[model samples]
Structures are given as structure tokens and as C-alpha cells.
Target: MNNQIDTLCTESWSCFKAYDIRGRVGEELNEQKAYAIARAYAEVVKPKQVVVGADIRLSSKAMKAAVCRGLVDHGVDVIDLGMSGTEEVYFAVQHWQLDGGIEITASHNPADYNGMKLVGRDARPIGENNGLSDIHKVAVQGHFDNCLPQGEKLTKGCLSEYVSYLVSFINPDNIKPLTIVTNAGNGAAGHAIDAIESQLASLGVPITFIKIHHEADGHFPNGVPNPMLPENRAATTQAVIEHQADFGLAWDGDFDRCFFFDEKGQFIEGYYIVGLLAEAFALRQQGAKVIHDPRLYWNTTDILASSGGQPILAKAGHTYIKQMMREHDAVYGGEMSAHHYFRDFAYCDSGMIPWLLVAELLCVKSMSLSEAVEKRILAYPSSGEINSHIAEPHKVLSKVKAHYSRDAVSIDESDGISIEFEKWRFNLRPSNTEPLVRLNVESRGCQSLMEEKTTELLSFLDR
Candidate 1:
């Protein structure tokens, strides 16, 4: 304990990332560090009352306890939500109108890693631009002020209300008989799915749920629940095929991001999902304003334009997307990365809401998931994001910019360098925590052109 305190007070914390706190257990994060972080958060935000939760990682429980202890020690009341996902913390903070919240999770990271996501009032993320840096400073120094009257601690559960609110997004009457396959990947999504399943049954929505790996196991018996990896997707796709379900959904460990697979066991890229959801919102509320990231948004913009919706572009990140959603009062905002934000949900992202909305759309449109997104996919063929490692990202970016500027019709550098032409467009942006740059190319109604441009852009890295 003494050694830990000395280390906390003397050393800098490498876990403080740009948007959230995340690192390997023991080496970068531990119980002591978690406590210091929570205390620092308390001193910085000074919330009267805050909610705390944790994912099913082995280290999460200990981390959450330390965090709660620190909060209470700083005279900040703590509301323990028990074992929950990142979005649940966001919901509790916003739904209960609490001062702040924290969820101990690494969200798709390996089992040896655990971290925390912090949010302020109304669940606004506490990123570097906001208050996370201040928290880091206090935590690293470990020079907290003398303890005041220790705040009380309490326990609460909001799963039922949260599921009810999610189901409220769609009319049960519109939902038709369907069979759906859900791959929880042994994460926290199963709990939410079970609650939603019961709610749908009570509402007389005749839908069958085929669940796989539907238990919270920190051991991750079936590997991590990250659907982004091609290897990790085969299980859900195979399950969808074997069950002959209408569609399938999968979520990460924290259940903040959701991924979809069609009835044919095809993994639909998230780029198409954004356009599908944008069209859904536009049809429901005519001329609805939708926010989208700058990366690979031709399909989204085209759909919004045709659907009589206004398309607003923001930098590609959850923090920026949520902030922009609030600024424009956008009804919905989506990142091709599968983070969906809604205005009614306190401008926070929810994995459960996106799937429900998509399911309802399937019933209302009388279309399969594949059929719903087929046209959009064809209209804008995209070379899903490709990443390249470069020693000096700036020099390569400069070269690419100079080379492309001559033929580029327009260039926007809001988030990264997005250059557009009459037939195709591409966005190149540096990774937040690596020497890599990500590139996404899309062409209007031309897969071959999109592929050609993607190859051309990738070759720039070799130069």
C-alpha cells in the first residue's frame, strides 16, 4: 500500500488517453490508481452525486470498488449500478439527472486490460478537451485536500426502465413475426437482451430470439466480443445461418457499440447501417437533421439528401459526434464505427437502441436487413477503412495533399484531409494513439472506381 501510494504520487500516469482512461491492469492501472483517479475526478468535477458501474472484466469489480471508495472519501455521494455496461452508466447519469458517472470497462480490449469511462452532467463525456486532463493531474500528484464529511453510498438498478425506454422508440404494433439471432459474445449485452425480450413479449411482438454466448463471463471463453475482426464475426454469421434467423446482432464487451449481420449471414459494413438509420429517422420525422462523421459518408449524405434530411458532418469520434448532435439538435447521429447517438437519449450512444430501431424498420419496410441496405450499398461502394503505418504521418499527409489537391474538386480538413472529386472521394486521418493513418475511399455507383482509388491512395504510403 505504501509503495502504491508513493508510485501514484511520484510517477505520471500513462493510462490517460485523449478521450478516456484505458490501460493494462497492474502495470498501467490498478486498484490504487483507480482510487486516485476517482478521487481526482471528485475533486475536479465535484459532483454532489455520481453513478458508477462496471463491465464483466475480472478486474472491473475491484476497480469499481476503489473508484467508489475514492468518490465517497471526497464527500461525493456514489450510486452503484453493480455490473453494467458503459452505456448504462451514461443512461443512469442522464436518466437520474445525476452530477456524473463512471463505468469501469475496456470495451473490446483484452482480458488483462480494464479502464473507466467518465461523463459529466447529462452524460457528456469528460474527454481531454473538457475535464479529464484535470482529473489526471490530480490523480498523478495524489495530493488531495483533507477529507470533508464523507458522502453516503447507495445501490440502484435501472435495467427495467432502460429497456422500456429503448422499446419506446418503435411501435410494437408495427413489428411483425420474426426470428432474430443474437450473439452476446458472453458480455453484458445478454442482460439487456433478456430484459428487452421479455418487454417485447408483453407487448405481443411475436419475435423469437436465438441467443449464443449469452452470459457475462469475464473469462471470455469464446474470445473477446469484438465483431470488427473478421475472425470474431464468423460465429455470429454462422449462427445467423444455422438458426435461419431474419437477422443477427453482436455487441462488444461493454455493449456500447453494436454490429449487425443479415439473414444470409453477411456482415454488413457499418457504413451502410448509418445510412439505413439516417433514412429511418428522416422518414419518421420529415427533414430530420442527421449528424455523420467525415470518414466514408457518401452513402449517408446521399441517403439523407434523398430522404429530405439535412446531413451535418462532424469529426470522426464519439465525443465530437455527441457534442455536434446536441449543437444541431440532430435527431440521430451515427459513426460508421457502429456508435449510434440519439437526441432523446441525452445525446449519448446506445447499442441496444440501434438494433431495436433497425428491427422495427425491417418490419415496417417489409424488407430483409440485406434488402434494406442493398440499394445504398450499390449507390455508394466504399473500400471499408484501410490503415497504414508511417514513421512520419505529417510528411505523408503533406505529400498526399499536394498530389491530390490538383485534381481534387474540394478538400475539407475538419477532422482530417477529405478530398472529393466528381466520381470519387477519400478521407485520410491519423490514428489517435499510433503511427498509423486510416483511409476510406468511396465512389458513386462504381465499385470498380472505388477499388481503383483505394489502391491508388494506399500506394501513397509506399512512396
Candidate 2:
């Protein structure tokens, strides 16, 4: 879009996708770009102080240093949180009362990729609508004209406090008897969860835990920690079956989202998890506001509606939902992508909260993970996200919309394009995280209809 941008360099800036920034490391993302973003970000937010963190990417330390340099050079006091997950940076910004934060990560992207997630004061995301585009424009201009008195970079070791904050949220001792298998995929979550597990034990809850790839090996020898991928999640499910564990869990590279596998080695739909969290949050805060994406479960909507909570449908992305949560003072917001935001926790999405909630659900229900999730599946049968890659994702969406929108009971473009019928609903949205338009469908107590719609939608999406 920047026409006069001759040196508008980097690996295509594909990292600047729909949500946050992400791209391959040496190829597109590097210290120069990181510094550029940091300088521009400080100019926009005009923060007196900012917290910064980085994942375990081999290139992250240098990139983080570059980011800190940019901030400090612009008279922004830098509270370097050091190496941490994306959520930890979010935590430090609010928990430590910093003005804003930036986390260097590519999340589940391959080891060679890295990027930054910029936030405003109180850990709010800086999307294109808010200020990220301006930051990008500044970075592209390549010359920062606004340089104030150089500030200092101070180290803030808040991982201990971060661990404490997460532990305090859940009744660790009261957790139900259960077994959990998780693969951190050699990301920073391994270190954080290991610390939290100790806290859980101190609460007198003896949880049987099995962890695979529980080391900060950014090499990702076991593959990226993104459970959204079938191959990446295969080992996790197998581990659950092998141990007969209550459930299997996995996190992204920086642990911003959590995914689950039932005791039967089945991956539970993220929509149901959103529903379960909504009920839990509503019970604690009566008549609270809850936000949900309209992808897989109308049950989440219906449940929140009946649970004495106000249900609001949000566009399916972190940027939109978090702002809505803060505006409405929502107790919680959830997406089928497993992103969960808490109003009390600075309105930032967390990968850790869901795991703690699931642990509690196991204790309270006296049932295996499969048994607990099976009820929801029966309530709204789903067609798991199926993706098809073509030259043009929009062309495919347009074609699918032509067929489904004619008799549509409801139509939505919240995430992608969603068209609803009397008894079924399906959405075909291009993946910001990938190169395909994902198709997810659910039917109201009609397995056959669910299948029929799923087949038809996939057939169309595939083209």
C-alpha cells in the first residue's frame, strides 16, 4: 500500500498480517525491522515507560536488544522483562503497572520466523484501526525524526510474580483428582508451567502430570507447539492415549493459546471450551458480559444467554474482542481459536487460564475429559476446520456466499463469511494464520444435516 516505499524492505511484510506481526527470521524479520517498529511504537503511544519480552527464538535476544535500543533512544524507559512468553509481557505491562508492552515472537511460526506484538497502556492490542498501521508507516519511512533524551533500559525479573499471579487465580489445592498430558513444543511455556506446577503441588493437590518437549528448545525438534496443526497435535493425542490421561494439552510457541485433546484421544472443539469458560466466569460474576466468536458453537451463545450473562457476538479476532471486552467491562471473551481474554487480567488473552480452568472442571465434574466434553459435542455437532488453498481465497468465499446467502437465515462477515440456515450454520473464512479459508459447520442436533452442510461447504471451499 505504501507506493513511495522504495526500501519498504523485509520478507514481504507478510508478518504484518491481519492481527499481529509475524514473519520468517533472517528472510523477512530482523533486528532492523524490530528497532523500526519499536521506535515508531514509542512515538505513537508516547509512553513514559514500557515493558518488553521475547521468546526462545535463537534470534530473539538480538531482536529484543534492538527493540529496547529503539525505545530507549526515544526517551522511553524500558523495563526489559527478558525472555518470556507473549502473555508474560502482557502480564508485566498491567501487573507491573507499566505504560505499554511489546513481545517479540512469531508464535507458532517455524523456528526461522519472529515478530512483535505491540500493545498500548493496560496491555491493549495496537491493531491497524488503533495505531499499528501508523507504526508500520513510521517504520517504512526509515528515519525517526522524533528522538528525545535517551532513556535507560532496566531489567525487570517479573516471571516469579507472573507465576504467582496465575497460581492465585485458581484453587490449586482444590483441583479435582486428574491426570494431564501436555506438550510445550519446546517453548517458553515449559519453564512457566513447570514453575506453576510446583505452586499447584504446594496447594496439596497431587496432580499426575506428563509433559513432552518440556524444554525451551526453540529449535522445535518436536515441531512447532501450535496444536492447530494436525501433525503437531498428533504426538499430544498419542501421549494422552498412551497414559490414559484425563486430557492432552498444547500451547503455541509463546503460549498465547491453549488446545485440548480428550481422554479418548479426540481433540475437543474450541467452541465448547469457550462455552465452559463462559459459564465459569458467569457463575463468579453474576450478569457479567461475555464475548464469543460465531464459528463453531451456537451453544456457547445460547449457554451464555441462559446463564444470567449478557452474550455479545464479537468479530473473530483478538483486536476486536479485547476492545469490546474493555468497553463493556466484560468478565471474559473467548474465540474458537482458543484465545481467552479476562477483564480482570488487563483484558488480554491468555493461554494459561484455560488450562487452569480445565483442571478445575475435571475436579468438579468427577469425570474424564472425554466424558465432560462429549455432552457439548452432542449439543452441537461440528465439522472440524477443513482448509483448501487456491490462488484466490476471496473468489472461493464469493462463490460459496452466492449459494448459501440466498436462503440464509443470518449472514455474517465477522471473521470470514458465515451464512446460517434454519438448523445449521457454516463459516468460510480465510486463515490469517495460514494460506487457506477454513470451513467450520455445526448443526442443531442433526448429524446428517451437519455432514451434508459440511460436505457441501467443503466442496465449495475446496474450489
Candidate 3:
């Protein structure tokens, strides 16, 4: 290995994770490293043109500039989308027919963190198994051949087109006139929400939007925009109750994953939302196939079966979900972590489309958001994902498997160890992003049983 590559590997290989590149801004990831990675990516993918976008992180601009420079130096034409969400890069690549795309974003990570997500033609992901590893190898080498003619760079705005496409997912005339609360949590979501609201007004849709933390502040004055945390959801939940809104919505830093709230100020789990959206899409296109992650299963599978739709289980991750959706030509795919993928959207996950579909579902069904998902929740009670930071995750998984093997009616390890019994099932998998083990348990119409299994599993993992 080259001395530079040796240095990077020894010092800060933490930036290169399983699915995407992420790390602390200046310490682990910097402009020079960003440039090296982009050059390596260009060398590996050899794309004629690439779309580049950045989030509102303070370091994103410089990082994006370095990446663009590297791509341009390699004779790859660059279409810069300026500050944008991760999905915008996906949209731009497919919409503009670019050869590849890159988004400089760390999603819901702290303000001090930043990263990059890459996609090939058709917005196909380049994760660890495919091109990311190659990029890492080439990046560490840090050597690039000279190009006689450097590539050209052009800047463009994609917000309007993206917003129009988002609104096209649902019929504006059929949507009910309801007040909805939206919290951007001071992330990049504010821009898209504002644009969508403007487009809705122009189309004369009588929807009222209540906004909070609607500014793009990198300091994260409100908190990181991850609604998965109970504390971070209080603002959106409270706003829904105070404004008497039909429902509430929030998005992470890059606006790729969105979370939902009910009319009664209750936060909805992403697992149930998967079922709800699956049913919605199935109602529109009968016999449509829906893809879901392996972490939580019963609710989504049951809903798909009842809706006359095919349900496919994919290993959990954006790259795997998108690849499976394309392979099966599935209409929609969702993960419990709020990543919702659509066939219509280049098989890319969007934080914007889920809430739009939910709103339209409420309007057409004449049911409140709570009422829409209550049946599914009661039918399959889940102990939302519980994470524990343990030193020996693999050993713990092996122990858990050994303990449950005999009792489990069926066992599988597509993504992790998933054991199923007569009435309940649980999945214990090591997290890809963090040093932790994530546990997800669900029961058949038994909340108490779900709780019991969750407690038991926690005890086993903790011990």
C-alpha cells in the first residue's frame, strides 16, 4: 500500500463504514480526503457525467467543492445541485440521465459530523460489497492519472422539479383540507417542505401546514433531527396537539428518512407506517409487490397478504432494499428506520413521499392518521428496536441463538439471527453504523408477550 493509504488506514479508517462514508468533520474527514475519495470513485466508476449535492452541514460546501474538483480533474462533467437532500442527488442522476451521483451529507448525525453517499447509473447504490470498497482501495492509494482535457462544471437548482415530482405521487384534488404540523428540526427538510407548501398553494390544494424549527441551522439548536429518539420527538408531537393538526411529520438532516405522528400527539413507529403505505399503494395498484427489511416482519407481511400484494423480505440497508426493489420491480419498499423507497422514485428512499401518501390515505379513507394504523398496531404489537452497546456482539448473538434455537419454530439469518416461535419472533443483529446490537421483537396480537420477549432478550444481551 502507498504511504498515504497506509497513513489513512492506520489513523482514520473509521470514516469508511459498511454502507456509506461518515465520520467527524475535520478529524476523520476533511477536504483533502474528500478529494481523494472522489478521485478514486471517478477512477472506479469511470462515469462521463456525475451529479453532486450537499446538505446544510457547515463542512459540506468545502467537501463538495473538493469532490467536484476531483471529478472535474478526472474529465468527468459535474452537475452541481448546490445544497440539497440525499434524495435530490438520486433524483438528479436518474432524471438527468447522469452516469453517477454523490451527496455530501451525514443524515441525522451530530453537526460536527459529515459524510458522502454515492450512486451509479439509475441511482443504484455503491456500498461496501460493490464499489465503496474499491473506492476505498483506490482512495488510499491517492494517485490519479492526468487528464488532457478536464471536465466541465455546471450549477443548477432542482428543488422545484423535485417538489413537483413529490406532489405528483398523490392527487391534489383528492387530498382533504387538513391542518398538518411539520418539524424540520433545524435540518435540510425545511427547504423541501417550504417548496412543497408553495407548490400545493399554486395547485389550489386546501392543505394548511404548521411549521416549527423550519430554519436550516447546522448548529442544531433544537437537537439532531433524528425522531427515533423519544426526546427529539416532543416538539413535533406537542405541535400536533397544540395546533389540532391532522398529523405531524419530521425529517433528518439530509431529509432522506421521515417520521410520523398521529392527531392525538402519538408518535407512530416506522414498522406500522410500512404496512400502512403498503396497503395504500396496493389499493391503487392491485397485486403490487412490497419489500421490507428482515428486522420486523409480521405486520408488513400480514398487511401485504390481506391487500392482495406480494411481500418480499430484504436484508436491512438502503443499498440492499433498492437493489431488491429493482430486481423484483416492487412498487414500494420500507424499513422501520423511516427509510421508504418507491419504484416511481428510481428505487430510491425518500423522506418526503411517505407523509404525502399518508395524508392522501387519510383524506380518501376519511379516517384520522391514528385510526388508519390502529388496527395494524393492535394486530402485531412490536417492541420498537432496542439497541445495546456490547463488547462482544457476535458472541452475544451466538448465545442468544443457542438459547432460542430449540424453542424457535423457524430460524433464519438473512441479515441477522431471526427466530420465530408460535406467537412471537425477535431479530438480534449487530448495527452497521455503530458498535451495538439492535433487538426487534413482535408478537401476534399480544403486546404483553412482545414486552416479555423484549425484556428477556435485553437481559440475555446485557448479561
Candidate 4:
């Protein structure tokens, strides 16, 4: 046992990141390390009953089993929801009132990578500050105390219930008959979409779904299943244009974030979707509080104000956003990265709910998705997040601040450095998970101004 522990501890703990566990599958996160992580999590969290799920990764099954063994060994009963998106585990934890939950997934990483996302009761994320740090420390130590009697494992299928819960977010009768293209990117979203479609059909909802890359292939034959990348969006855009669909939708590996494309096959910036959804929820319940990240704002803030809702700005990560949502009892929260959080859905982000609400909005407004977003797009044009790899992100940020602080109308450094001028503004922040610095520029109804500012910021950052 000592020799085994020594071997496990020798592996790099880099897989345990700020928000969740993630790394290359074999080298950094094989079965032994997975077992150690689960054991460490069990020791730290000490939950009586936990829910576990995995994405359709080639290594996920083995990892899942190893995690379950560690949890069960620690006398924690495990509710296994086999092959699921991260959101499913979130749903199961809250819906079933489990003590905690863990989903084994690397979420849109390459096929060679796999990891885990952990949550406690009510689906609150276990992040670095909250519990992930302790987990990392204990995981590195690779030591655990075994229980006298191992806990039993059980399998639970929540897809039907999960689909039903998702459908309840919007009235099916209000969803108009429409042709839509959905690109699953050959990940776990296809199955969820299928289940939702079945439920919609049962309710007599007339919706046409043109599915692309629908298979859950762990090999990711169609690239890495990430829709954020421009190159990855080509197939979905082309399919939407070829099918002449109303709009298009795409999801990453674990389907936590969803992306949208207009009828013209133009990729809609996620910044606009945050405003759209905020407006939708605000109109449904007037004066509702909406939470938005500080990265890209004006549009969302304007929409919320115009719709008689309060806008609260939170930090840019899921963990921070979820915490803010609960604090303010916000109706919804969104990040420009396409993660949408619903208070009704236990403040966890869902790729599924955003589209449902958007579809409902299209029906009620009697407009195409493009028409719905066109006004907002023109009102607040933006440069979608531009990431630059830099050795000294902080130094570059300071340099940019020094250049603009003199002329800036307002400057804020809550998550990153955000400088505002009269007509245009930009935010430059280091990524929470990666070494790159992300820059976002937006102007008040001025596309050219946004372009100029984005280029200017890149010039400073590139140096």
C-alpha cells in the first residue's frame, strides 16, 4: 500500500485545477490518480450519499468505476447516472437531494483528456476556494481511511425526469413549429436532444430538428466538440445555411454551454444571448434580478434596465456566477462564454435551457432568431472574446492600464481590468483555467469603433 501510494503521488497534480480536475488522460489522469482523487474527495467532502455521472469519453467508464470504488470504500453510497453531461449530475444532486455529486468529464477537451467536476448538495460547485484545494492537497498525499463496511452502489436513470423538468421551463404549446439545426458535435448532447424531442412530440409540439454530428463518439471524429472555436463552427453554420433552418444550435462535449447561429449562418455572439435571455426572463417576471459577468456588459445591463429588471455583475467563472445568483436570488445569470445559469435549475448552467427559452421567444415574438437579436446586435456591437497567449499577462494588463487610465471615463478591476471611454470600452483579463489573456471590446452602437478598439487593445497585448 505504501509503494502504491508513492507511485500515485509521483504523478503530477496539475490535473486538479482551480474549478475542476482536468488533464491528458493517461499521463496525468489515469485510473490510479482517479482513484486517489475520489478517495481524497471522499475524505474532504464526507458525504453519505453521492451521485456520479460520466461523459462519453473513451476513458470515462474506467475513471467512473475508480471514483465509485473510492467513494463506496469510504462508505458513501453512490447513485450512478451513466454517460451524462455535467449538468445531469448537477440536476441529480439537487433533484434527488443527494449529499454531493461528481461527473467524470473533461468537457470539450481533446479526446486524450478527461477530468471530473464536483458539486455539493443543491448543486453548488466545489471550487478551489470552497473545497477543491483540500481535495488537491489530499489527492497528492494519496492517503485515506477505509470504512469497516463499504457502501452499496445503485443505478438511477433520471433522463426522463430531467427532460420533463427541462420542458417545464417553457410551455411546449408556445413553441411554434420551426425548422432548427442542432449540431451535437458528436458528444453527449445528442441523447439529451433526442429525449427532449420525444417529450416535445408527446406534447404535440411541432418542431423540426435537423441533427448533425449527433453520435456520441468518444474519439471525437469531428474534432474536439468545442463550438467556441471559429473553425469548429463551420459544419454547424453550413448545415444551418444548407437546410435553411430558422437558426442553429451547438454544444460542447458535456453540453454545459450551448452556442447559437442565426438564419444567415452567422455565429451569434454569446454576449447577445445573455441579453436576449435576460429580457425573456425579465418579461416573464417583471423586475426580476439578472446576473451577468463583467467581461461584456452594456447590452445585458441595458436590456435588464429597459425591461425593468436589475442587473448585477459577477466574476467571469461558473463558480463565482452561481454564488452571485444565489446571493441576489437572481432569476438568471449568463457568461459571454455561453454558460447560462437558471435559478430554477438550482443556479447551475445548462446548455439545454437557453435554446428552449430562445425558441419560445421566437414563437411569442413571431420573429426569426436573427430578427430578435438584430436590434441588440446593432445596439451594442462587440469583439467576441479574443485570447492572446502571453508570458506576463499581468504586466501587459498593467501596461494597457497605464496607457488608457489617463483618458478612461471609468476603470474597474473586479475580475480584470475594464476601462471605459465615452463611446467604447474594453476588458482585458487573464483566463481562469488557461495561461492566455482574454480581451473583449464593445462600443455603444458603433461597430467600427468596436473594431478599432479591439485592434488597438490587441496591439498593446501582442507586444
Model 4 poorest ten-residue lDDT run: 140-149
Estimate, for each residue in 389-447, the C-alpha lDDT of model 2 and write its tens digit.
86798888788888778899988886788889899998888877567677889988888
Q: Itemize residue pairs with steric clashes in candidate 2.
A: 11-28, 15-22, 176-363
Candidate 1 clash pair list: none
Q: Give the lDDT ranking, best first.
A: 4, 3, 1, 2
Ranking by TM-score, best first? 4, 3, 1, 2
Q: For model 4, what is the alpha-carbon lDDT of residue 449?
A: 90
How far out, in Å, is residue 131 in model 2? Answer: 0.5
What TM-score does prediction 4 earn? 0.98
> Against the unseen true structure, what C-alpha lDDT does each candidate score?
0.90, 0.83, 0.91, 0.91
Off by over 4 Å in 3: 1-10
C-alpha RMSD for every candidate: 1.8, 2.7, 1.6, 1.2
Which residue pairs show collisions in model 3? none
How far residue 389's Cα lies from its native spot in candidate 3, in Å, is: 0.9
lDDT of 3 by residue, 1-463 (tens): 2775567556665789888999997898998899889889999999999999999888999999999999998989999999889999999998889999999999988888999999999999999999999999888777778643799999987788888999999999888799999999888888899899999999999989999999998889998888888899999989999999999998999999989999999999999999999888887788999999988979988888888999998999999999899999999999999999999999999999998888888998899989998998999999998889999898988888899999789999988899999999999899887777899999999999999989988887778
* Candidate 4 lDDT by residue in tens digits, 1-463: 7987898777677887778888897787889888888888888988999999999999999999999998898888999999999999999998899989999998978899999999988999999999999999898888788644798899887999999999999988898788899999989999999999999999999999999999999988899898988999999999999999999999999999999999999999999999999998898898999999888999999998889989998989889999999999999999999999999999999999999999988999899888998999999999999889999898988899999999999999998899999998989999876678999999999999999888877887777
